[model samples]
Target: MRAAVYIRVSTDDQVKHGYSLAEQREACCSRARILGAQEVTVFSDEGISGSTLERPGLNEMREAAREGRFQLLVVRDPDRLSRKLAHQLLITDELEKCGIKLEFLDFDWKDTPEGRLFYSIRGAIAEYEREKIRDRMGRGKEQKARQGGIPINFDVFGYQYDPETGKVSYLEHEKKVVVEIFNWFTSEDIGANGIAKRLNENGIPTRRRAGRWHRQVVKQILANTVYIGLWRFKGMYIKVPPIIDENTFYRAQEKLKEVRRLYAGKQKHGYLLSGLITCADCGNTMTGAYARWWGKRERRYTCNKTCQGYKNEGCRPVKYILADALEEAVWNQIQTWLMDPDRLAREAMGQIVGQNDPREQIMVINKHLASIEKGQEALIDVIAKGYLDHMDSIEKKLAELKRRKEKLEKRKEELLLAYRQREELFAKIDEIREISESILRRLDDLAFTEKRSLVRALVKQVIVSGRGVPGGNGLRFINVTVLAKIPEQKISS
Candidate 1:
């Protein structure tokens, strides 16, 4: 009979209880040999958490057992098998299915009923330990949350709060990204799907830490009051770090509340462009309103302005587009944009071409730094030669040169950071292009106001100036201003 020995030692086990790897391996191997086994194969899971099913060595041993490489399996104790009862039961069922007899050096399951009971009790004790540990960790997190520090389940982005020290710190670049999303959604009146599609197109990772972004993530970002300095823990407000200004945040919330009110008690109201359309004439946003007519669904973008003073004032006629037709037009535009892949690639490459070479810039700055040092030394030398008449001028010149040198060195560092970002973007150029094409394709499939939402993502503002297109009847020229890539600016309020 061939025997396989499995051993596991967690970080906590090694430190607190001294469950050393060498001792476990020695005991398991000795016991397997003593059990009249012809061959012994040892499997060790070191520095692995027993709570998770990611143990490498344990997986290999289980595979070997299934292949009939070992007829008997030995462990130092039942705890070595697993810390969780459910996991232990699963392992036992798998071993049984493979017709492999599991053995514990401290347990004699095949010998007597008393031994079986002892093994069961030992497994229970291990399970209790794991539960205790889990409970302690959960309690610690709850305590931190109660003390005005956000509980760290890690879903919240933009800023990280250390529960131990209660020190809230922001990842500068990531925070800016979040702010951009918020601004794009509310101010630009972009829908959740459109925002998510644009973000995915720009190679932004999704909320699930997966390869793609989802509309739900966009919704969460829009509804998250935490960005404006309100921290929520388990659905209750706790601690927060101020990100956006209070006024802007309140306005965003107000818009969100209005959107919710508009869609209340209606099924199928969660359309892509539900909350983003604005009135071109009255300057009020067009809220989504629907009515059943002749057993057919009719959707209209109604201006929030109730007074119709301009109705008879000979103003530009309000053009109300059918939701479906609007969505179709937007989709057609997206399809046209993505059909030429070569153009998109060229456009992407053009953005990074004029960036300064960080290495050359650093070298130039270093030369200036050396010259400053030399100038300081020369000034000291002249002062030491008893020529103190122009000493003050020389000193001032040296100070100015030193400051300029410092500024250049700092600028070089900034250039290095920009270069690193360009390098990363270049590496993912192909992936970025593919993502962009996919986003355009997806946007082209949305209906009505949904299409308008896709437009809102790329556009900052759409001003309808009550001006009609040339040679067209009452068709107003919609002036669209796009929100292209811009250098990040720090916003402190």
Candidate 2:
């Protein structure tokens, strides 16, 4: 039977047990040869977690198995296949179904009942090993959390965690985006849909893709406590590098509360405007109400608990507004504001408002290069002293200095790129600024669809006044609030 040898060495195992990639491959090959396999194909996954099935070598082996390239599988141990019983069982079941025999070098497969018991025990031992590993990890994370250290894993966006020092720092660029999200929701009172709409319109990068923003992405930003220098681990809070202060975090939470209250009790009545409308009287957002109006079908926005219960008190019951009518109003607003030539010009100019100065970046790079040179001289002097133990320590210092030097070189390159693109960057900034300025200049220039998009971007909530005032006035009082840092523009009289 043609046998495929599988080997795996996770990063943690490699560090703790000196389980080098070469050693694992050698052991697997030896076992496969000892088992008398006619053909041997090796599958190796290095520095990869066995918990995930995304390993490249594992995928290749599985594909080979399906294609009848191998009728038997050999491994150093069951753990090499998987530490999780579920995964192990699934793979073994699949292999059995495919008429492939799986053999473990450390495990003897005798035809007797006692041998079967041994096999079961071996699987149990593999599971125990996984459990022990998990327990140790959990304890370590919990300790780190309690000691005010952020849990170390893959770098979380908007955060920079130092593995050596166990300290966390915020990624400046991403933190700014996070702050903008909070400002949009709390100060602007923008809902999830509106936040998402605005982000997509502005070409902001989303969390899922390399450079795309979504509503869920904004929500995650708002919910994250890293902005406040505190993280929630297992439902408990641990302090870390703060992106925003406690006050801002609390305000964002309050806005989230309001959003939940707006949709507390409602049913879907239409698309687009279904979850956007809110009541102005009770401060409760309206829900979509659908029914047969006139001869054709129509959708309306209304409040469940509109006016105060008392007849003598509170604003009168508000009239239901058609979704299409409001949507048209919004689109018209967008065209007038976003597509205006003068406004676009102003925004293009404002695009480079917050760019890093080339001189500052150069200064930083020069400082790093100077330090690296000093470190190199020191390392040479230490080497000349002939102190073997001190030489080992100095070597590490020299290596670290070299790494820093490389990083500075890369930063210098990036600074050069930024300098080259400075003009374009400024134009881009002007574009965004112009878009915002145009909206302030001509609110009437927008078409129905454009206005809707604009409202989603600038105007968070539109408060439609309750039924006619004391003397039955026909005019409705509509109060519109804008997002953060947006200039309040005076409409041309």
Kindly report which residue stretches of model 1 are placed more than 4 angstroms away from their true locations once superposed.
Answer: 18-23, 44-48, 52-68, 86-102, 105-110, 150-155, 162-164, 197-214, 260-493
Candidate 1 residue pairs in clash (backbone atoms < 3 Å):
323-448, 327-448, 331-444
**Runs in model 2 lying further than 4 Å from the true structure:** 20-38, 44-48, 51-73, 85-111, 154-158, 189-209, 223-225, 241-249, 265-297, 300-493
lDDT of 2 by residue, 1-493 (tens): 5888888889887787677667877776777778787788999998888778788998898878766678778876667787676677677767765557887766675536796567667777877887898899999988877876676562666877677777677777777777787787878856766777676677766545554455566777788776776677877788766777788889888888777776564333333544455555666666566645557666755565422121222234445556565555444444454556455455444555566788688898898798789879978987788767766678778767765675677689888888778766555556666666656665656555664465565544555544422121222333322221232232110
Q: lDDT per residue, candidate 1, 1-493, as tens digits?
A: 7999999998998998889889988988888888889899989898887877679998998888766688889887767877776777788778876668887777666535675566667678877876798899888888877877656744467876575675777867668878887788678866666777687778876434565666666667767778877777776677567678777777777877877776575746544444445555666655555745457677644453323122222223544434443333333444544566455456667777776667788788788888888988888889889898987798788757755765676587798888888788776666646756766566546665665554554333322223334333223344322222221111111
**How accurate locally is residue 364 in candidate 1, as Cα lDDT from 0 to 100?**
82
Judged by whole-model lDDT over C-alpha atoms, candidate 2 comes out at 0.66
Supply candidate 1's per-residue lDDT for 409.
Answer: 63
Q: Per-model C-alpha lDDT, please? A: 0.66, 0.66
Clashes of 2: 36
lDDT of 2 at 215: 58
What range of 10 consecutive residues in model 2 has the weakest lDDT sum? 484-493
